[model samples]
Target: MKRTILVLSLAFCSLAATAADTSKGAESTAPTCPVTGKAANPAITLVYEGNSYAFADETAKQKFSDDRANSLYQKLGGKTAIDAAVELFYVKVLADKRVNHFFEDINMNKQKRKQKEFLSAALGGPIPYAGKDLRSAHESLGGLNDSHFDAIAENLLATLTELKVDPQLIEQAMAIVGSTRDAVLNRPAKPATPAVP
Candidate 1:
């Protein structure tokens, strides 16, 4: 679940701007609307549960407000479920021949804590992530590739399945993880191809 949420949350963050400027009178830094991925109007805002959300318009603001009750974080049983999933995931990862080498000499206690924090925030938990960006963290691993990522993702899916999480949710979560592939692999993004005239 943590893996799923982390991927989804990161995907959401990569696609949408959850942090739009909400200052009372100042001009915004062109914050993108989480609902529309368009520049948000600082004046159009909603302060839900202490997090101020800026919107492109009233409709966007309303959508964000309504969606809060069903955030991925809450749906994945929040912190408790995330914690359990991360713990189980590490066990699988550590046991897997494909990815175990990545953690052989690392401090697991700290790694698990970071993973929990990262996945929690990625899944929309209240706390923001305070760790190394994915690229930098994995760039030093020399030969990291898609196959390794696939292995880790496979383990995550297996863990979630064993935990009996809903299949639909797992699919959603996997899509999110899939979006992080390039970043996790530290690869340069493919340039957008031009549209046919």
Candidate 2:
């Protein structure tokens, strides 16, 4: 289960990098409190990762701050760690035959930077991801399939493991990454089965 999540997260991270778009510049006009999901108090705002977030109250502000402080992005050592992982991941990917073709014509430096941003956002970093959604981006790949996705995930898992990231944290990050599978493949989301009591 844990391995699966890490792989998926890594796969999603790579996809995020190649096709992401820029987000709006930092603004003070957040419409809701990310912590409580309530209307924001314009006066109770904070800027993080180049974006502005507002809170309903002091408690909400603190809660949001604490969450960011404890996020997987923070746990993985922030930008430095993320940057190192992306670099290592691409080395493995470029050497792999299964998915390297997809990136054959891509500008890697830009892709690496985008991947960092995507992984940071996916891992609960302070900045929200404003890139083109996964489906649109992956759709442009034309020949993507499960095996390709799995290969990317595997590379990601290996990269994290080699980096000695905590097992539990890798699992958490992977679960988040795995959630993007359907969209990354540009397929329909699987419907949840109804509960049978």
Candidate 3:
């Protein structure tokens, strides 16, 4: 029992260190109380998605808890759910012919970790993503087109479906992901055409 506890302690320390490393030198932003817009009391901390978020007081903490409980992230089972979905999502991505080529020289472990962070924050997880913006990250992927993007999106939808996620939630997630298309594509938005005068 002592050995098991020690092992778990080491594993947890490793994970916390890794998260700190990913922050890449910048200190974590101090959380503000959402209700009062004041600096949070460090003692009133709540752990979410493996990170601690401080609240100004017990009341502020309660409000944040209430809001998070109804969030899509919470609805989808928080970090564990997002992590599983991203892992499965990438397995599908790498096996797909249309997208697999782009990842041939990539470090898949790092890629998977980054993807998890990106998706979690995008889906309203408590932690903010610390990776490159979408445009800069994909700018070097030559010959990427709408078809390739579609292939990626399709695999994501299929993966979510196979996981038996709620269809409405899946749709909402897709819509949010889809909104990143222009940035991911590394292009300026096409100007809207004016109506005929």
Candidate 4:
């Protein structure tokens, strides 16, 4: 538990230090709208949730502004924030006994990079995720159950909390992550059985 806290503290400080250095003069660095896949016009930038985001045009900008759940990637802080959160999230996961064994033979460096990509794209970032779909990725990890899933979710929430993420944003994140639960657990799709005639 102490280790978890220590890891999160260091990660939070690291992100803070980095943000302090770049945030002073930072403009909206995103060059395209994640939703529209179109060139972002800097003049059309919208400052949503205190973060400025550039959109391809007024339509894309409006879409982003109108949707809170879809704009979480930016609302929570965009690429830099996602990277830091993933780092701390992994630290918590590795320390937790509940889900650590599943990662024993995995390459953490690659895993972290993939996770960042997956989450960035999942949270509506412009980049498309290139990794295997969730079912293929976790299908080999036999016996994964809701408990393991819960532990991972718990660690993620902890990471977000330690980083002082807004509760509302955390709720959005959890919902997005939860949407992947069935696939992550390798559950087969249960097609609706035809009702007895």
Clashes in model 1: which pairs?
none
Q: Candidate 2 residues 160-191, lDDT tens each?
A: 99876779887877888888999999999899
Ordered by lDDT, highest first, the candidates read: 2, 4, 1, 3
* Model 3 pairs in collision: none
TM-score of each: 0.65, 0.71, 0.75, 0.67
What lDDT, from 0 to 1, does candidate 3 have?
0.72
- Distance (Å) between predicted and true CA of 105, model 4? 0.9
Instruction: List the candidate 2 regions with Cα displacement exceeding 4 Å.
Output: 1-56, 193-197
**lDDT values of the candidates?**
0.73, 0.77, 0.72, 0.74
| Top candidate when judged by TM-score against the true structure | 3
Error of 4 at 195 (Å): 19
- Expressed as tens digits, the lDDT of each residue in 129-154 for candidate 3 is 88999998999998988999999999
Candidate 1 lowest-lDDT run of ten: 8-17
Model 4, residue 14: distance off in Å is: 10
* Deviation in Å, model 4, residue 67 alpha carbon: 7.6
lDDT of 4 by residue, 1-197 (tens): 01111123443442211111223334554887755878888787655323566778888766765554345675676676788889889989999999999999999999999999999889876457999999999999998999999999999999888887777778888999998998898877767789898
| Every model: Cα RMSD to truth | 8.8, 8.1, 9.3, 7.1
> 1-197, model 1: which lDDT tens digit per residue?
33333222222221222233233543333487878889889898765433566789999877765565456765666666677778889999999999999999999999999998988777676457989999988889989998999999999899778776677777867887887899999989878899999
